[model samples]
Target: MPAEVDLKRYSKRFANLKSKKETPLTARIQIVGIGDDGLDGLTGQARQLIKNATVLVGPSLLLDKIGNTDSKRIVVGSNLQQLQQAIKELGDSSAVVLASGDPLFYGIARYLTETFGKDRFEVIPHVSSMQLAFARVKESWDDAYLTNLATQPLDRVVDNIRTAELVGLFTTESITPAVVAEALLDRRIDYFTGYVCENLGTPDETVTQGDLQSIRTQSFGSMNVMVLVRRHGAADRPSGSAQRRLFGNPDDLFLQSRPKRGLLTPSEVRCIALAELSLTPTSVVWDVGAGSGSLAIEAAAIANKGKVFAIEMDAEDFALMIENAKMFDVPSLVPIHGQAPEAWKELPDANAIFVGGSGRIVPELVSSAIKRLTSGGRIVVNVSSPDNLVAVQQVLGDAAMQPDVRMINIARGQYQLDRVRFASLNPTFLVLGQK
Candidate 1:
């Protein structure tokens, strides 16, 4: 039969079938995932769903690749609202949405599930292109940071990539692999090996590997995934975000209320406190009494992959910490407004903890936090008074191994009209213990 004749016959058959069926059929939606293998790769269930679908919706590439199924096809254009309207018009007809790879991982299924309820979709997920990209690069992506350029912009994704060991990105034609390489080099991040995997799961699949400078001029196909593997022994970024320090950032650089500025942990003390905790790239940390979030923000930067909870009871301090965290551009820092012991009830066990305060209750907070620390976990406490020092030391020393104690006395330089002056901050005591 001629191709046009077959299409006409199928359309007539579909019209007659629709007339016979009841109006508004409550058919289940089949969100099917396909790869480069096309229809041959689909499971028996997925194949049947696509074959019997009353209506089909998907990207143009997928529709072209799937060939002819004779179903009422609707191309999902760049405008998602149009697709939503089409699906709404379909009523409850069988909708077999053709998608590539696992639709849930940065795919169309998220939007569909959101637009229509989850109960409407029966998603058949396939091997994600991200997984294939990592497998081709022979890297473990369990700890790798994964994101998509189609939804998330480069700036937001790049910040999270600073401290990541491995990064897998879904690249678009406009924001190609080369664009990402240039962005990384522009930020002075030169310690990663970039790989571009194109036409994944197909016979023409290719993986290109190079440094940022080498990949800067290359253009890749529209369908590609970019992977970045950080070179061993390389720091997250050279100077910690253009002008800020990775940790122990100056107290004044943070956004703080005038009266609480003096109460916040000093840069000198934070430096020592951070060093005592012995942070790693993926360590769960907690900052009790996280005033202005100075300590919590630094911890979040160091442990970018891990979670950091800044537990502060004071409403003013909690609010200040949130603002300061944003100022520092640390996304992993979570501000908890409630008091500790209770606030930390639902939090994960901490690999490192920092407690800052000079009140008599500092000892009690330290004791409670120590109880929640993981084995071999370290805790650092900073106090300004002898009474707090003695009390915290006693409490920590009793619950942990013998504590390491230090007294930090800091001074800053000042020059006015060819004259030099030295200003001194109040002395503080740092007590560190390992559980």
Candidate 2:
């Protein structure tokens, strides 16, 4: 039969069947996950439900299978709203929604249930792409860290991945496997074996495996799953190295410059100032007069996924900032080598600002930086001298919105040989203001 004739006959048959069944049909919805092998991949019950559905909806790629449907058919590219509307319009009819892989594993089942209530539909899940990837690789994913790059920040994902022996990630356009590998390589974390499983569970399925260095120079197809397996004994040495029980970290971790040796803000003071800054994972922060960038570096670690702009006027400290940022694996900390207030121009307003300076310009710098703070933002100043404190308090106290101040006297215990002695790093005062 001719193609046009077949379509006409098919439509007539559907109309005839509809007229014969005059009884009111019960309204129902079914979400089905189809694999690369198409409908044959479906289970017995799932296939039967799809075959008898009165209305079918799915992405254009999946809709090709039921294109000859005698019932209503809708092809959606990416408009989820249109799909929802079509589902709503298919009231009192047996409607089936088609999706790729398992519908519930990071799929549409969750959204559909949330949007239309759980009792209104049934979901038939299939083999998820992650399961298939693991099967192909012959590896168990019982302990692997899994996350979606599409919804999470790449920096955060990389940060959490530091301790994982194995990781499985769903990559987005901006965070492809190559980009992820590059990020890891930049942090000197290059001991993982990388793999990209493309077109999984299909005839043209291709799995490309390589080390982080090799993967950093490769490309992958759109449909793929990224996996990372850290080599044995390749995990971060001296585990819990990032965690600090006390307020201070070992001074050696920081990239310190000579002549400015003691100028680096002690970690004890930096900890209190950071806490006063009200740091959060998403907070935008600035560290002015960031000597050796110690405060900003530690602040960056505390605010893992947040943005930290470390502005330093000294040339040597600015260079040290970059080295410290790399050592800490904090890609979000930006080292700005210029004077404050003027250096912060063109950047987004900060949610928190930390000022550490003993210079004569402390008062003016704090006042200028405070103006760029967002509403409800916090400002913390660490000043050692009583004169600088008085100067800053005078300006801040007179501002339209004045901040609260506190004096922090931190003392640490030192044990040399068999004798124990108390060593006071500094008696720095912290002033906190909110806008």
The backbone clash count of each candidate, in order, is 0, 1
Q: Give a tens-digit lDDT track for model 2, residues 45-136.
A: 98888889988888878888544767678777557688778778877788899988888777778778888888888889889888888887
Model 1 weakest 10-residue run by lDDT: 233-242
Candidate-wise lDDT, in order: 0.82, 0.78
Q: Write the per-residue lDDT of candidate 1 for residues 1-435, one digit (tens) a residue.
A: 654567888999999997895665466788999987678777888888888898889888888877788799998876879878877887777788888999888777888998888988889987889999999999998878787787776886776566567899988878988999888888667889999999888888999999999998988888799999988756334233447889978665665553344787888888888989999988999998887788899999999988899988887667767767876778788889888778899999999999888778889989888889999999999888989888887897688478778998889774321235777999989988998
Winning candidate number (lDDT) = 1
Best by TM-score: 1
